[model samples]
Target chain A: MNRFGFFILFIIIIFSSKKLYSKNIKVCSTCEFKSLEMAIESSCNYDSIIVEKGIYKEFNIIISKPLTIFGKGTPTIDGNYRGEIFEITSENVTIEGFNIINVGESFKNDNAAIRIKNSKNVTIKNNFFENIFFGIYLEKSSFCKIYNNSVTGKATEELYSGNGIHLWHCKNILIENNIIKNVRDGIYLEFSNQCNVINNISQNNLRYGLHFMFSNDDTYRKNNFQNNGSGVAVMFSRNIEMLDNVFQENWGSASYGLLIKEINDSKITNNVFLKNTLGVNMEGSNRISFKGNDFIKNGWAIRVRGASYSNSIVKNNFINNTFDISYNGNINKNLLHKNYWSKYNGYDINKDGIGDLPHRPVSLFSYVVNKSPGAILLIRSLFALILDFSERAYPIFTPTYLIDNEPSINKSE
Target chain B: MIKILSYCFYDITRGYWISIYLSFYLFLGFGLLFLNNDISSAIITLMNIVIYLVPFISLIFGLTYYYSSREFTELLLVQPLKRKTIVLGQFLGVSICLSLSLVFGLSIPFFLVGAYNIENIFDLFVLIVLGCFLTFIFTSISYIISIMNDNKIRGLGYSILIWLFLSVIYDGFLMSFLIYFEQYPLEKISLAFVLLNPIDLARTLMILNLDISALLGYTGALYKIYFGTFNGIIVSSIILFIWLLAPVILMLRIFKKKDF
Candidate 1:
C-alpha cells in the first residue's frame, strides 16, 4: 500500500509540473519580460506569450521553440526596413494577430515578413503585413496553414518586388481567406505539391496574381484575381484543379486572364473570365478539361498557340468576345463541344435545343489574324466577311476538323 | 427645295419597293433578335447586313429611281427651278427616305425587346448614324453616275461596279497589300486605306464603338490610340461628314454641266 501511494504521488507531481511549465508569459513595457526576445529567451517549450499593443523594432526574430505567440491588440513588429521580421524553424508553432511590416529589400536575399523554413504544422493567422519584400514565405515546410492574412506592398517594378505568399518546396499547405495585392505575384508556388489555395483575393500585383511553376497536384478554388499585370500563369504544372475563380479586368497588350503553358491533366471549371484582353492563352497544354466557364466581353476568349492536344472544352459560354477562339496551327487536335457561342448563326429546326449544323468556332479571319496581326485592321471588312464565308462553304484555310459538332442551340443558364 | 423634297418623299414612301425594303429590314431585325435572344449579337448580325446590304440596296434603288424619274426631271427642267435645287432636292429626298426606313425598321425590334435600356445607347446610335451615312454616300455616288451616263444600262452597270469596288475589291486589295508588305509598318497606310473606303470607314466607326478594336491586335492598338479617344471620334465623324458632302457636291457639279 505505501509503495502504491508513492507511485500515485509521483505521477501527480509530474502532471502538475507539466502544467506549471506551460505557463503564459506577458511581454510589455512594464512587465518583467519587457522585450519579446527576452521573453522568448526565458520561456520554456509550449509556453504562451501574450504581447501587448506596442511597437517592437526588431529584425531577424528567429523562433525555434514550439510555442504560441498571441498579440493582444495587434502589436506592430517593425523590421525597420532592415531584414526579415520573423524566421520560424520549429514545428507546431502558432503566431497570431500581429502587424508585421518593413521587410528589407535585397537582390540576393528573399527577406520576408514571416519566413517559415524546414518547419511543420505551423499556423500563421490573422496577421497584417505591409511594405513587405516577401510575405509569409515558406521554404521546405509541410502541413502549414496560412489563414486570414492581409499582405499589401508597393510593387512598381518586377525586378525589385517579391511575391505576397510564396511557397517553395512545400507540401500539404492550406492557404485560405487571404487578401494579397501590389506584390510581384500574389500567391506563388514553386515546386510545391498538394497545396490547397482557397477563397483568396489577389489583385493589382506587378506580375501574375497567382503563379505556379513546376507545382503539381494543387487545387485553388473561389479565388478572385483582378487587374494584375499579365494575370495568372500556370507553367510546367500537372493535375491542377482551378474552379469558380473570377479572373477580371486584366487588360494589356499581351495580358491574359489565365496563361497556361505546358500544363497537363488540369480541370478548369465554372470560372468567369471577364473583360480581359485574352481569357485563356494556352500553349502546349494537353488533356485539360474546361467546362462551364463563362468568357464574357474579352478580346479573345481562347488563343491556342503551340501544339495543344486532346484538350476538351465543353459546356462553356463564349459571349460577346471579339474572337471566340484563335488557333495558330493547322493541325486540329483539341475537342470543342457543346459550347454556346454568341456568334453562332445555325438553326434548330427540330427544336431539340441543339443546332442542326455544326458550329465552326475558328473563323478564317482568325487564322489570318494569327498569321499576320496587321490584317486585324481589316476585321469586319467585306474581304474578311467573304473570306470567312468562303472558308465556311469550302472548308479550306481554317482547320476543317476544328468544329463544334454539338453546339448548344441556346445560351447555357 | 423643301417642297420638292416633300413631294419626292411622298412619292418614294408610297412606292412598293420602298415598302419592300422597309419590310425586309424589319423582318431581318426582328428575326435576328428573336433568334439570338441577345442585344449584342443581334447588333453584330445587323451590322453585317447594314454594311453589305445597305449600300447594295441604296445603289440599285438610287440608280433606278434616277433613271425612272428622268421624265419628271425633264419636266422640272422646263420650269423656273434651278438644276442645283432640283438635284439636291431629289438627293435629300431619297437619302432621308431610305435612312428613315432603316432607322424605323431596326429600332422597332429593339424597342419591343427593351434593348434601349439594356444596351449601350451610343452603340445603337452609332449604327443608325453609319447606316444613314452609307445611304447618303451611295445614293449621291449613284446620282453622279446616272447624270454622267444617259444610258440606263451603263449607269446601272457603273453604279454596281462602284458599289462592288468600294465594298469588296478595295478591301481585297488592301488585305493583299498588307499581307505582301507584312514586314513594313502599315498602320498609317492601313488607316488611310480604311478612310478611303466609306464602307470600311462606317465599319471601323462601329467597331470603335463596340470596343473590340483590341481584337484587331497590333493595328487595333494603333487604331485605339487614334480612334479610341474623344478627339478620334470627332475627327472620324468629320471625315464621314466630308465623305457625305464630297459626293453630293461632285454630283451637283456634274449635274450642272450635263447636257440633258
Candidate 2:
C-alpha cells in the first residue's frame, strides 16, 4: 500500500474503534454499580449511564467526560440544600430526564440546579427543577439547548432568588418550551447573543418575566408572560426581534407589560399587553418598530419618556386604556399613525375609514400626572375631564406635534 | 312613606318624559354596546352619559316635578301628615323613581347581553350605585332650589345653572386654580376639591372601582391608598351619603318655615 492509502486506513480504524469501545452503563439499586458517582468514575469518554428511578442524595457531581447520562425514569437528584448539583465542564454532555431539587442558595456563591461552564453542544432536556436558587445557569457556554424543562422556584424577594434559565456570555442557545415561574426572572440573558427563546410560559415571577440586558440579535417569540412583577424588560439591547408575546395582568405602581429602555433597532410586533400599569414604558429607546400590538385597559398604554427618538408606533390598537400615549418631553421624534384609539371622537368625513381630524393622545391630565403623580387622585373628575377636553380643543400643555394624523375610525381588531 | 312612594313611582313611570328618558338610556346602552361590541368600552361610554347627562336630566326633572306637583304638595301639607314626612316622602319618591328608571334602562340591556357574570357584575353594580347616588344628590339639590324660589321659571333657571356649574363650570374653575398654582403640591387640595363636588366625588368613586387608578399614576397611588382599601370605600360612601342628605335636610327646614 502507498503512504496516503495507509493514512486514510489508519483514520478510519481510529474512528471505528472509538465507536466500538463506547458502552452503556446501568446504575440501579439491584445492579453492581449502584451509584451515579461510581458509574461516572469507572466510565470512559462517550459512555452512556442509565440511572433508574430513585432518590440520589448527592451534590457537586462534576461531569468532565463527554458522556450521555440518561435516567430510565425521572430520578430525583436531591442536593439536600447543600450546594450545587450537576456542574458540567465537558463538551458533548447530555443530561436528560432528571428531577433536580433543593439547590442550596448562597450569597457568596451562585448555586444552581445545573451549572454549565465552558461547555459546548450540551443538551439538558426534560428536566424538572424545584426550590433552586438558579436553575440551569449557563456561563460562557455555546451551542447549548435547554428544552422542555419546568423550573419552579419559591422566590420571595429579588435579592435572595436567582433567575430560572440564567445565561451569561452564552451564544447560539435554544431555550424552548419551558415553564418557569416564581423566580426572580423567568429567563435572564446578559451579554448573550444569537439565542432563540420560543414558546415559553413565564408567569408569577417575583421580578421580571423575561429580562434582557446588553444582549443583541436575539429572537423571542410566542412567549406568555402573565402576572409578573414587571413583565419583560429589554434594556441596553439592540437588533432584537420580540414577536407574538402575550404580556398580561402585570399591574403595579411601577410595573410595565414591556419595559424597553435604551434598546435600539428592535422589532416588537404582534404582542398583546393587557391590563398593565403601563403597556410599554420606554425610555431612551430609538429606531424601533412597535406595530400590530394591542394595548388594552392599561393605565398608560405607551408612556414614552424623554430622549426616545425616531421610533415608529403604527397600526396598534389602544382599547379602553386610561390614556393612549403619554410623553414627558416636547421634542416629538416618534411617528404615531393609523392606530385605533377607542377615545378618538373625530369623524370620518372623507369615507376613507380614517378620521379627518387628528387624535391627540397625550392628555393634559396625563401630563400633569407625569409631573406630579399625586394629581392622579383627580382622575376622571369633572375637572380632569374638562382639562383633557380643553387641551384637546386647544393644543396647549400637550405636545402639539405628537398627534396621530391617520387615526382609525373603527377599533382595530 | 311607602304609599306615597308607590303613588309617586307610578305617576313618574307614567309620565311621557320619563318614558322618553328610559328609551333614550336603553337606546344609548344598546347602541354603544353594539357599536363597541365590548363590555368595557360600553361601560366607558355609559360612564360619560351618567356623569354628564344623568345629573342634568335629574336636576331638570326633579325641579319640574316639584313645581308641577305644587298643588299636590299643598294638598299633602294640609293633611294630617307632618311637613317633614311629606317632604321626605316626596323626595324619596322622586329619587327612587329616577334611580329605578336609570337602573332598569341601563341594566336591562346589560342583563340581556349576559354581562352579569362574575367579572363585570361588580362594575355593573357600581354603575347602578353611582346612578342612584347622582339621582339622590341632584334631586335633593333641585328640591332645595324649587323650595327656595317660589317662581317656577327662576327655580328652573337656578336648577339648570346648578347642574351646569357642577357638571362643567366648577371643573373649569378647579382646572384654572390647579393651573394657577401648578408650583405647589396639590394632592391634598385636589382631593379636597374632589370631595366638595358631588359629581367629582362620584366620578372618583367610579374611576377607583374601574381599576383605572393605575393610570392616575402617582395621584392614583395616593387615591389607591385611600380609595383602593375598604376603609376608603366607606369614607367616600359616607361623603356621598352626606351629599345626599345635606340638601334634603335644608329643603325640609326651608319647607317648614315657608309662607306658602
Candidate 3:
C-alpha cells in the first residue's frame, strides 16, 4: 500500500514539472511598452506581444526573449531603407501577421525581411513582405515553421537579386502556404536538411520558381510553380518527396517544368506538368519514382539524357505531346509502368485500369530529333508520317524496353 | 572631286588604326562563344569570323564608305565635275576600298582554318560574302538617309532603327506572323520573308549548320529546302546577290534624282 502511494506521487511530480515548463504573457502599447524590443526585453517569460496597427519604422529588432510576436491588422514594419528588420537569435519565437516592406538591398551583406539566424523553434506565419531581397532567411536555424506569407520583389536586373524565402544550412523547417512572386527564386534551399514545403504558389521569377541544391530529406507538396523563367530546378540532392505540385507554362529553349539534374532517390508523385517546353527533364537523376503525375500537353513530356538509371515512371498520364518521351541514348535503364496515355491504342479487356498491350512511348521521330534537329520540320509532312508509321510498325530504331505494358485508357474521365 | 574621293578611300584602306575595330570584333565574338556552353569549337570559330567579324567589318567599312562619300559630296558640288560622274566615282572608290578591307579581314583567318579541311569552311566564306553584301545594302540605305536628313543624329537614328529592324524586331515580327498563321503551310511563308531580310538569310545559313536546325520547325524546313543541299548553297548565294545589288541600285537611282 505504501509503495503504490509512492508511485502516484512520482506521476504527479512529472506532470507538474511539464506544466511549469512554459509561461505566456501579453504586451500591449498601454502595458509599459513603446517599442517592440523594449517590451520583449522587459517581458518575464514566453510573452505574446500584441503589436497595434501602426507603421513601426524599426531597424534590427533582435529578439533575445522567447516570445510570440503577433501584429494586429497587418502592422507595417518599415526598415526605412536602413537594414534588416528582425534579427532573431532566440528559440521558440513566433512572429505573425505583420507586413514587412522596403528591406535594404546590398551586395556585401545578406539582408532580409526577417533574419532568423541560429534560432530554433521559430514560427513566422501570415506575414506580407514587399521589396524584400531575402524574405524569412533561415541561416543555421532549425525546427522553424514559416507559412502563409506573401513575399514579392521588383528586381529588374539579375545582379541585385535574392530569394523570397532563403533557407541555408538549416534543418527540420516547415515552409507552407506562401505566395511568392517576382523574386529570383521563390524558395531557395541550400545545404539544408529535412524541410517541408507545402501549398506555396511561386510564379514569374527570373531564375527558378523553387530551387534547391545539396538539400536532402525534404518534402514539397501542393506547390504551384508557373510562368517562371526556368520552372523548378532540383540539383545535387537525394531522398526528396515532391507530391501534388503543378509545374506549368515555363517555356523557353532551355526551360522545363521541372529540371531534376544530378539528383537521386527522389519521388515525384501526383504532380501536374502542363504546357512547358519540356516537362520533367531528367539528367543524371537515379532511383527516382515519378508516379501518378500528369504530363499534359507539353512540347516533350519527358526527356532523359546521359546515364540516368533505375528511375520509374508509374501510373502517370502522358497526354497530347509532340513527343511523349525523348531519350538521347539507346542504353535503357529507366522503366515506364502502368501509366495512362491518351495516344495508347491498346485494348484493356480485363476491365482493369491496366491495358493488355504495351505502349511504346519513344518514337522514331524522337530518335531522328536526337540525331538531327532539322528533322522536326518534317513533323507535319506526309513523308515523315510514313517514316514514323514504318518505324512504329517494325519497332527497330527506338529503345525496345521503353514500353508501358499496363496503360490506363480512361484517365480524365 | 574624284581625286579627293580616292584619297578618302586610301585613308580608310591604308589606315593601321582599323586593327582596333578588328580586335573589338574578335573580343565580342569570343565573349559570345564563351557565354554559350554547348557551342562546339568548329561552330565557334565559324561564327567568330563569319557572324561577328564579317558583319562588323562590313558595317564599319560601309559606314565609312558612305560617310566619306557624304564628305566628298560637299566638295564635289562646288567643283567643275558633273554631278553624275562625281557621284559615280565616289561610289566606285568607296565600294572598292570597303570590299577589299572586308575580304581581307574575313579571308585570312578563313584560309588558315579551311587549310585543315574543315567542313564548315565553305559556309564560312559564303557567310562572309553575304556580310559584305549586307554592308553594301546598308551603305545604300545610309546614302538615302544622308541625302534626305541633314541632322547627323537623325541619320544615326535611322541607321540604328534599320539595324534593329534587321537584327531583333524582324524576328519578333516573323514569329508573330508564324504564330498567327500556324495552321497554314509555314514553309512558304518563311521562304517569302527570308527573301526580305539578309540577317534572316544569314541566320538560316548558320542554323542549318547546327544539328538542331530541325528544332526551328517550319522555318527550318524552308531553310533546308533552300539552303540544306549542295544546290541550295548556290541558290542562297544568288538570292544574296539579288538582295545586295537591288538595294544599292535603288539607292543610286534615288540619289541621282534627289536634291541634296
| C-alpha local distance difference test of each model | 0.90, 0.87, 0.75
Candidate 2 colliding pairs, count = 4
- Given the true complex, what DockQ would model 2 score? 0.46
- The best candidate in terms of TM-score: 2
Per-residue lDDT over A1-413 for candidate 2, one digit per residue giving the tens place of the 0 to 100 score? 99999999999999889779998899888987888889999999999999999989889999999999998889999999999999999999999999999999887888999999999999999999999999999999999999999999999988889999999999999999999998999999999999999999999999999999999999999999999999999999999999999999998777889999999999999999998988999999899998989998888899889889899999999987887887877655789989998899989987999999999888888887776555566566666776788878887778778889999987665
How does candidate 3 score on lDDT? 0.75
Error of 3 at A46 (Å): 2.3
Residues B63-142, candidate 2: write the lDDT tens digits. Answer: 99999999998998788988888888888888888888899999888888774466577887888888899998889888
Best by lDDT: 1
Error of 3 at A13 (Å): 15
Flag clash pairs in model 2: A373-B218, A373-B219, A374-B219, A376-B219
Question: Could you tell me how far off, in angstroms, the CA of residue B154 lies in candidate 2 after the best superposition?
Answer: 1.7
lDDT tens digits, residue span A133-214, model 3: 7788999999999989999988666678888999999999999999999998889999999999999999999889999899
RMSD to the hidden true structure, all candidates: 5.1, 3.8, 19.0
Estimate, for each residue in B1-260, the C-alpha lDDT of model 3 and write its tens digit. Answer: 57756766676656764555555444544454455432334453444345433443454455545565575577767777676666656656555555555556555544443332455555556555666676566555666666566676776677667766665566556654654666676676667676677776765666566443434544355566677677888877788888777766766677668776
Q: What tens-digit string does per-residue lDDT give for candidate 1 at B106-143?
A: 88877777755434566778899899989999999889
TM-score of chain B of each: 0.97, 0.95, 0.76
Q: TM-score of each candidate?
A: 0.81, 0.90, 0.60
Better of 1 and 2 by lDDT: 1
True contacts kept of each: 0.59, 0.52, 0.09
How far residue A99's Cα lies from its native spot in candidate 2, in Å, is 2.1
